[model samples]
Target: MKNKILVLGSLTLLSASLLVMNSCNSLPKGLKTIQDFDKNKYLGSWYEIARLDFVFEKNLNNTTAEYSLNEDGSIKVVNRGYNFIKNKYVASTGKVKFAGDSNEGKLKVSFFGPFYSGYNIIALDSDYKYALVAGESLKYLWLLSREKTMPNNIKETYLKTAKDLGYNTSELIWVKHN
Candidate 1:
């Protein structure tokens, strides 16, 4: 009986430790979240100007993301897009929490329960009109803007930055807002 109780306690402790470790995820190597990121300013809506082809967003166009504060202080994410091939609209809701410090742009977003992925904001304009976001690896990158269209200069600059970070900028798919 005592041996069984000890084993249970050990398992409980190990489970708790794993939970803690998962909650404290870090950004991918060679990527850094922006400093002094204000979540409040980042809230509201953003248009997906460009992105690398990812399964969740494949064949999607006219994509936009809405962010709001959840009751538990996590960011509520609503991603909506039009599937041109399917001729239908699709959306997925998720939650985002700071991976580390709240002031940094490093966050983990989960659409599936208890399974989080990195959402690191690598760059942003002072007015929060445009942002460059990186996922867990070079495979996932997004260029977002407050409006449907992004400026030429900003697009060029962000593409250069992504390329510098070892991303294949040529593979980027420019999202159509119409």
Candidate 2:
């Protein structure tokens, strides 16, 4: 009876762990990752043109992210930004792996060990010059471009798309490249 009870407890714990891990890859309702995503083409530097204000990026300007292939088949994510208030540069390194199909832009990224968050590329241009990324929920969104500045047309279109998807576009903080 003791052995049976122990086995049951272990199984229960394993089930719960799997559930938590899977939830980290979930996308927000009505949001979708781009199909036919070419990871190789997407792996490069991107400037943060706009984003919804978040604690990790608070008071940050001139932000950028770089991605490279890691030896372990994961993507290395390096984010750098200038903290105007702190008068210093800040950076964070993380890892990203495809959440499901490699052809899809659905990924899970983790800066902290054993905890992952959704990184869904909701929109991307054919040339890979601009991308609109959404997080696990409506509260997280980013407008990324290969250059420091995005074209006005692209910006307006992305904003409209975000708004259509129930995002609060007004809450976005336009990041300064300088």
Q: Which portions of model 1 miss their true places by more than 4 Å?
A: 1-24
lDDT of 2 by residue, 1-178 (tens): 9999999999999999867865767777888889999999999999999999999999999999999999988999999999999999999999999998999999989888767888999999999999999999898999999999999999999999999999999999999987
The lDDT per prediction is 0.92, 0.93
Clashing pairs in 1: none
TM-scores across all candidates?
A: 0.86, 0.88
lDDT of 1: 0.92
lDDT for 161 (candidate 1): 90
Candidate 1, 133-169: lDDT as tens digits: 9988788899999999999999999999999889999
TM-score of 1: 0.86
